[model samples]
Target: MTKITYVEPDGSRIEVEAENGSTVMENAIMNGVPGIVAECGGACTCATCHVYVDDAWTETVGGPSVMEEDMLDFAFDVRENSRLSCQIKVRDELDGLVVNVPTRQG
Candidate 1:
């Protein structure tokens, strides 16, 4: 399991044990972590699970693909580091991944 930390809009942090091959959004939903609506249920069709990856982890988390970028247009406060959590698969290399949840759903 990888360790993924999600910071809420209020600055509260939630650390979850993420299963390898699963998605960051799934881990958050499983843990009942707030701030991620995940209306599309990991389908990558919605921006409800948007998050800002920590600057330090940007290279590792990677940039959004064309499809993801298109969907992000519907997200609130989209940033250079913003990503759809469903697109972020958990991996051993991402053990300490940290992301900040936005204040509201997109």
Candidate 2:
């Protein structure tokens, strides 16, 4: 399992043990973390699970898929680092991955 740290807009932290192959949004939603809505489950059709990966972890997480990139455009307060958490599959190499929740999600 990889340890993923999610920092909320208010600076609160939610650390979770993310199983390899599971999406980051799955880990957070399953853990009942408050920030992520995950409205469309892990389908990458909804932008509710949007997050901003830390600059250091961006390369490690890589860029989003076409579908995810399309959905991200609908997210609130998107940024260069914005990502659909459901598109980010956890892996052993991402053990210390850190992503920050946006101030709002819909």
Candidate 3:
């Protein structure tokens, strides 16, 4: 299992063990992490699962895909580090991944 940390807008942190091959948004929804509405589940059609990739993990996580970038247009307060958690697949290399949840969704 990969360990993922989600930091909430209120500065609270939620750590969860995520299974390999699952998406970050799935882990968040399964673990009941707040701030990720995931209105479209892991389909990557909605921007509700938006999150900010922690600065330290930015390069590791890489940039959003062109399709993802288009969907991000609907996200609130989009930032350089912003990403849709559903587009991030969990793997051993991301054992300690960290992402920040926005104050609100699109």
Which candidate leads in lDDT?
Answer: 3
Candidate 2: the clashing residue pairs are: none
Q: What lDDT is reached at residue 100 by model 1?
A: 97
Model 3 C-alpha lDDT per residue in residues 1-106, reported as the tens digit of each score: 8999999998999999999999999999999999999999889899999999999999998999999999999999999999999999998989999999999999
C-alpha lDDT values of all predictions: 0.94, 0.90, 0.96
Worst 10 residues of 1 by lDDT: 10-19
The 10-residue segment with the lowest total lDDT in model 2: 64-73
Task: In candidate 1, list every pair of residues with a backbone clash.
Answer: none
Model 2: per-residue Cα lDDT over 14-71, one tens digit each = 8899889899999999998787999888788889999999999999889888887889
**TM values, all candidates:** 0.98, 0.96, 0.98
Instruction: Tell me the deviation in Å of residue 56 in model 2.
Output: 0.5
Question: Residue 21 of model 3: what lDDT?
Answer: 95
Judge candidate 2 against the unseen true structure and give its global Cα lDDT, from 0 to 1.
0.90
- The TM-score that candidate 2 achieves is 0.96
Give the C-alpha lDDT of model 3: 0.96
